[model samples]
Target: NFEGTFNTGAYASWGPTVANRVPVHASGPYFIENYRAKSYAVHTNTPSSGAFRGFGVPQSAIAQETAFDLLADKVGIDRLEFRIRNALQNGLPTATGQIFEKGVGIKECLEAIQPHWARANAEARAFNAKANGSVIRKGVGLGSCWYGCGNTSLPNPSTIRFGIKADGTIVLHQGAMDIGQGSNTVITQIAADGLRVPVHSIKLIDGDTDLTPDCGKTSASRQTFVTGKAAQLAGEALRRQILRKANVSEAASLEFSDGLIKAYEGDTSVEIELTRLEPNAFGYVFMAEETYDPPVKALDEKGQGMPYAVYGYGAQLMELSVDTKLGTIKLDRITTAHDVGKAINPMLVEGQIEGGVAQGIGLALMEDYLPGRTENLHDYLIPTFGDMPEFVNLIIEVEDAEGPYGAKGLGEHVLIPTAPAILNALRDATGVIVAALPATPDKVMAALMAHNEE
Candidate 1:
C-alpha cells in the first residue's frame, strides 16, 4: 500500500517523459497483487527532474527496503531469510503481471550471499558486544533489488551490421556508445564468438551515425542485451555465408587466418583464398545485417504488462560502524552478489559493480543537490578515494534464454541495492530510521535526538 507523486515542475509541459515509470517501478521488483501507485509531473517554478541511473527504481527501493527491514523485525525472521522466502523465481509474475519462463535469478543471488551475511552478522554482533557503552557501534545490513533490462514492454530495437573484407579482416559496425562502460569491448567479444574467430581479428567502428547502423542509445541498460544480441546474430549470419562459400557442411570446423579460410570435416578439408573470392554488393566477401528487439507486450489502462524481456537481480550487504555521539558513519566492507545471467567479461562486470557501489555510498551518506545552496562541485560533495570501503563481489550466472550467449545487462543493476543497504545498516547501528536521504551528520544527530525523546 504505497502511493507516490513525481513533480517535474516547469518542464512537465515540455518533458513529460518517464512520468509513466515512477508508478511502474514504485512496486519495487516484487510480486504484489493489490499494489497501486500514482505518479504525476506537475508544473512548478523549480527546475525539472530528469532521468538518472535506475530511472525511478532507486527512489522506490528506499521506501520498500526500509519497510521490508521493519517487516522482517516485526515477523521475527532473519532479514536474509525473509528476502529469500519472497524472492522472485522463474514462472512467477511481477507486479506488472509479466511472466518470465526463465532468467529469474533473485533467489540465486540471495542464496549466494548467505555465507557472507552470516559471517558478517556474527562479527558485527561480537564487535558491538565488546564495545560496552562505547560511543561507536557496529552493524550489518542487506538490500535486494531487481531491474528490467530494457524499455518496459516497448519496441526498443538495435541493429548491427558486420562484414568480412577481402583481406580476411573482420569489420564490425558497432553503433552502441561506450561512454567508458566497455560496450566497445563487450560487443566485440560477442561478435567474435558469434563469428567463431579470434577476438584480435575484429576491428570496431562505433558511435558514428554515418558508418554504423542504429543500435539505439546507450541508456536503460540496453546496450549489452540488445546491441550484443544484434552483434551475435550479425556475426552468425556472416559465418554462415563464409561456410557456404567454402563448400563445407554446417558441422564442419572453420578457421580464418593469413588471408585464407579453411573448413575441415573428418579427413576432408577445403581452403578458400581471400584474393580469389568474389566481393558482394557491399564490396566484401561476406556481409550481414541483423536487428534484435526484446519481445514485450504493451501496457493496458492499468499500466500492467510485460515491461521487460529480462531482468537483472542483485543483493548487497554492508558492514559499517556508526558513531552515535559524533553522528558519523564509517563503511568497513561491502559484499555484493549480482545475477548478470552471464559475465561476458569478468573484469568489466567487477568494475561496474565497484563503481556502482561507490555511487551508492555517496547517495547514502554525502551527495545531495540543492539548486541554490549547492550549485557547484564543492558545495555538492561526492565520495572521495578515502571514502571507498573493502569490496567483495560475487558473480551469479543464471542462463538467460533471450540474452546474447546467455548474458544480460548489469549497468544499472549494480547500484539499485547499494543505498538501501547502507541506510539499513545505519539504522541497525543507531536504532534511528532516517526518513530523508543523504543522512548527513546533522540529520543523523537530529534523528538520534528525536528517537531518544520518543
Candidate 2:
C-alpha cells in the first residue's frame, strides 16, 4: 500500500490567482481573507480514488473542522460566536478569490439559529453543571462551508427539449435523469408554466443519450437551475408561437392549467384548449431547445481566480453531551440555517439540507476512512439511527438573479459547513480540543487523559 500525507498549509496556494485580490471587510473583529488553497491533490501511487456520498469533502472536512475547535479554545471565545464573527456575507470574497455576485446567505443562516442556539447551549451548560463527579461530560459543535453547484473551470452543460406534438399535448424530452432528487417532477413544473399547459398534460420523455441533446451530468445540484430553466425557456417559446396564431386583438397574461390557457384581462377571462387550435393556422407548430452554463474562470498559478460562477453558504449548530469517563458522545439535537437562493421545491430543499447535516455530523463524530482500505463501510463507521436527533430547519430564501427562478445549487453546500460547527460546540461543552478525525473512543480517551493530567 502507498502512503501519503496531505497538508493544506504546505504552500502559499495554487490556482485562480485573482481570488486574492477580492476584498473581505467585516464590522466584527473577525476578518476573513479570500485565499484559494488547493482543497486536495491525488497521489499518483493509487490507480483511482473516489466514492459516492462525499468523494473528497469528508477527508478535508475532518482537518479543517478540528482546526476551528482549536482556534476557539486558543482565543478563549465561544465557538458559535467566533463562527458568527467570521461568517461569510454577500459582498465578501471566497477562498478561491471570487466575489459573490449574488445568493450569499451566511449571516442570515447564523441569525436564524440564534434562539435555538441560546436555548440549547443554556440547557447543555446547566445539565453539565450538576454532574460534578461524572466521567461523562457532554459537548456540542458547529461547522460551515461553501461550494459551487455545477462544474467549474471545466466544460459542463445541460439541454432541455420542448415540442408541441401533433396531438397538441406538450412533450418535454429531458436529457438528465432524476437521480432521486425529483428532477422529473420539477422539470414538469417548469414546462407546464412555460407552455401555459396543465402539469398533468405534460409527459416527459425519459433521458436517453441517443435521442436527447447533450445536457451534462445530473450531479452538482444543477438539474433544477440548468435543465429546469431550459425546459421553461423552450416551453415559453412555443407558447408565444401559439398566442400569435390566436389572432386576438387584446393582450393578456396567460397561465397553463388542465391542458388549457387561462387568459386574464383585469378579471375578464377566457379559457382555450391548446390542442383545439388549427394545426396549420401558424407557420410552425412550435419546437425549441436551450442550454445553461454558470459563468466561471480558471485558476492561475497561485491557485486564485474566479473558479466558481456562484457560491452557497450555511450555518449549523448541534447540542450534545459527552461521557468524559467512558469517552462516548451523545448528541441531543441539531438546528441549521441555509441560504438556498430560492427554494424551487421547498420540501426537496429541506430534505437535501437536513440529509447533508446528518452526514456532516457523522464526519465530525464517527465517519473515518482508512487510507489503505477505503471500502470497509462497517469498520470505517457511520452514524446510525441511535445517533440521529431532532433536526430544526431554518430555511432562508435569497433570490439569485442569475439562477433559474431565483435558484442556486444546494447539494454540496449543505454538507460543507456542518462538521466544523459541530466540532466547535463540542469544544464548548467539554474543555477538550480534538485535533484529528473521527474523535473515536480511543482518540477521545487520549485527549481526556491528557486534559486531566494537565
Best by lDDT: 1
Error of 2 at 189 (Å): 2.4
- Residue 80's lDDT in candidate 2: 65
- Candidate 1 lDDT over residue span 1-454, tens digit each: 6665566766754234466665766666566678777766677777777777877677778888888899999999998898888877788877787888888898898899999999999998999889978999888898888888888777899999999777878899989989999999999999999988888889888889998999988888899999999999998998888789878877888887767888998899999898787888766777999999999888888877987888888999999999999899999999999998889999999999998888888888999987668778888889987998898999999999999998999998888888899989988888998888898999999999999999
Best by TM-score: 1
Model 2 per-residue lDDT tens digits across residues 1-454: 1111333232323212112211111111122563323333433443333333433443454455566557776899866676677766666656545666567777777778878877887777777889878765556667665555665566576777777644455668887787777778777787787776678887778678876777778766567777776777777776676566443323557655444655676767666675665444221245677776667677677645665565566767777777777777777788878777777678888888877877877877888765567777777777777787788887888777666677777776677666666666657766776778667777878987888899
Candidate 2 ranges with C-alpha deviation above 4 Å: 1-31, 34-36, 44-47, 51-62, 72-77, 196-198, 247-284, 371-377
lDDT of 2 at 384: 78
What's the CA error at residue 116 for candidate 1, in Å? 1.0
Residue 52's lDDT within candidate 2 is: 37
Q: How far is candidate 2 from the true structure (C-alpha RMSD, Å)?
A: 5.6
lDDT of each: 0.86, 0.65
